[model samples]
Target: MFKRLYCNNYRGLVNFEIELDELTLLLGRNGSGKTSVLDVMFALCRLLDGSAKVTDSSIFPERTLTRWQGRKEQTFELDVELDVEFDGSVQCVPFTYRLEVEHEEGGRKARINREILAANGQPLFRSDRGTVQLYRDDHSDGPMFLADWSASALARVQPGPDNRMLTRFADFMGRVIVCSLSPASFATEAAEESERLGRDATNFAAWYRHVLQENPGQVAELTSELRKVIVGLDQLSLVKAGLDVRALMVSFAEEGSKPYSLRLDEISDGQRALIALYALAKLTANQDCALFLDEPENCVALAEIQPWLMEIADSCGESLPQVVMCSHHPELIDYLGHENGILLSRGNGGVTRTSKLKDVSADGVLKLSELFACGWEQ
Candidate 1:
């Protein structure tokens, strides 16, 4: 697993490192670099696709400034170094990924400032002039490939549990995806693995039925967990084919069936949210993959965050994927135990700090909601 991650001179962040584990959460006020952190992580995912490209995108100048916006210490530099428990022992993974923008007379493209990767804390690779390598292993026989095949390529590769695990991790990003805050319309996903319905989750019903036909026990567990988090969610029923299929679809017997649709739009907003969550939890729980969910507590009753988040962790741990989430909600912290959380924040003139919940006072939970009383409303 990736044990530590550090970044420097990237957007508002100057330099930062955080210990990491399954189920990490980034929290803080707006403009506090929370989204930037996740954006960088997602960028890494996007970067791994070999065909991806970097272009100068417009972010406000005031917003573009780092923690030391007008200070001399603020050289445009981003160095990423991480520690990973590779081969039963911890090894420092070297990273020197960086970018720089020119400000002279109508600024142009952000120069490909720097890119490098080192295994065991030593520079084995670096992008200079023009190049990138995102994935590589000191111990693997095969070369990893990501579509965005330039300067950041070595990062495209990571050590998976086995060859299969490694391949699955690199080949698919759905296992570790990010959904922007769209509490209203973010109801689904496109199926990456054929078993997966889709990100929009258009095939939720199909996938659910398939799982039931193949993995009934898991489906049952999912139903139970969903019931706990959703107030009126009664037992969910899927009609098996070769028998009964129509006039029912997947019925929430616990609630009024009320005729479901392809989009499952007939249900209450909360039900749709919970259904999406539960479906994802079930799909990802058994597999050893990772998922990055931001503001997972959205749209649900405040009281259910704890139980739902716990179920998410338990379900993910049960599956093959390791899960990490970011939230601005306190109830999430209240519900998720310390072991399940790694608190993420930016401090000290924009230095990012990552610490475990267990490290905090009294069971390691800091009552995060109250801490962000004014900053979370947006």
Candidate 2:
């Protein structure tokens, strides 16, 4: 699904690029900057959603930013270049944003240095001072600010002379779902949460119940898939997940329970993981989509991983939709047959260097555990 990824000046990543394939699995030890990779992908979606500022999308957050306050800091930059093909034609899209911070008479200030878009191999738009010129097919108008603008606003008033992959990728994210783990997906209604909780599942119970009543089919399908992921899991059920009495309430499977309150804490880690997996799997099973699971081993038990991976490979393996995950599971590597799908993280002095397993040598493949244990090297 994700053909390639390139990022610069983003936290642990300075300049990075790698080729990706369907079923790509990125493996690295903790702090190998694996989580950062997921962060960047989500940041990409946020940009397309117009919910995050370019600076906010950066790895260098304002609160944590500390770079010799007395001296000038080099500009922070983020660039995402992608190759996407749709309807039989491939297109190259690049999104680059640059910001410079300097002390002005003892006060720190930030200014944009480069904001440009290139299609194929040529520049479509460049912003010297926030002046953006998106191409003709672009639905964005003028100098857009994702931090403060809405999609409807951009679609209604964007300049028509510039184009960037973000233009289409932005549109794709609305329909594309990328999530880690939110409580509501498996929360019990009476337990104090709902389904489809906004991004974080802060109010999970109410949303879960409401959706079950509104779209019972979606919930039923999700439950069915979850049961498959969790071996020997039969009679799967959700507690206090939907709404009740025109007001929000949780539903439970207990005897004589009012089904008004459900808590995420009640579920096991394995169950919670399955909930996320199934929810996304259900999506791919229904639409032309791709699922990205970052470090799926988080809650999924090591024993169940192989069966689960095979399950995904068999069910969606042929067509319609697909699933690609980044994992560090050894059984997963062995089950997949070829280490070619594996992507190792390696670099010079840096803590991360991610590339496919197909590139690893005999030692690298034979002693995979040692390689993962070594973390990173020169």
Candidate 3:
């Protein structure tokens, strides 16, 4: 689980830092940098897991630098706590990972300037430009070599008995899920399995296929939960559409008629969102994966919001190790603000800042959402 995040000169997040809990809620107005925070985490995860390069324009464009700051350096840091089995006993370990990217040639290109990963204040991996230093689990220097300046050296490390800690950290980062679901972009057909879910979930069918293959028992539990919220939902399955293509199919049972089925794309946006949410919560339970959801309340019915929130809340810390959500819905604010909310605001210069929701003073008459709607939070 993420204990804290620090970002410098990334978009509006200049010198931004936020402490996180098991279940944290980000509450703010539009353009307050809530989604940007999620983007940074996702991009870093992708980079370190070898799925994306630091110079990938789609993930880290030149415009990602703060517009007002003339500095060409952008820095990001994360503090994570994980429970690991060490020396035949499970122990909790604290890890810190930091990366600095420098834009060159007037922001036309970017490369990693420095990257470091430490466990319990001991360096596990360090890189400066092309010079790299690797350390083993026993805190001894392992290897020193030159690495690609635009890619993650940690991702390229080979798994070995002496480097289990480093490999475990990499695996944990690979499992971190960050997404803002766009059901309209969801593809019904999947040509092959995807190990990672897309940031927009456009490849949801392929990702779901992978999930079903990896955790069939969890998929069954997810289907049972979906039936309660999704009207008449009987089962979810993947059927062959072509020689190597499969399509996600949803079955519904009616009271006085024969059961019917529909393609995933044929379902309404709300139903799709609900199914995705339920699947996300159920399939990843107890998997040591952290979830970051951006505005999950969108496209969901007002009445259904609280129940799903409750489901997520019930799973956090036990079934789900950590979850961070961004929302503007009143149901979410009233239910989670006082306990798990972090209020984000922009200064006059457009720099983003964060404050704990419980620290904000209220008249005790209006709810947190009401205060936000009336601009009291600003």
Better of 1 and 2 by lDDT: 1
> What tens-digit string does per-residue lDDT give for candidate 1 at 95-197?
4433332232233333334455444444444444345333335533343233332223434444455333324334443334544434355323322213433
- lDDT of prediction 1: 0.50
Q: Report the error of model 3 at residue 62, Å.
A: 1.1
Q: What clash pairs does model 3 have?
A: 286-319
- lDDT (CA) per prediction: 0.50, 0.48, 0.91
Candidate 3 local lDDT, 252-353, one digit each (tens): 997888999999999999899999989899998877889999998879998889999999999999999999999998999999999999999897799999
lDDT of 2 by residue, 1-378 (tens): 355566554555555555555566666655666566666666554544555444452422433222323333324334434455555787655544433332234333333444454444444444445444544434434353432211112222332224334455444443334445554343344443332333333344444454456556666666666555544444333433336322332233444543333234555766656555554555345444555566565667777676667667766545324455666666655555254354545466563566555555545345554455564321
Model 2 segments more than 4 A misplaced:
55-60, 63-113, 122-126, 138-167, 175-179, 182-220, 228-264, 284-289, 314-324, 336-346, 363-378
TM-score of each: 0.62, 0.65, 0.98
Best-to-worst TM-score order: 3, 2, 1
Give the residue spans of candidate 3 off by over 4 A. Answer: none
Residue 281 alpha-carbon offset, candidate 1, angstroms: 1.9
Over 4 Å off, model 1: 56-108, 111-114, 118-126, 131-169, 172-175, 187-262, 316-321, 337-360, 363-378
Q: Which structure among the candidates has the greatest lDDT?
A: 3
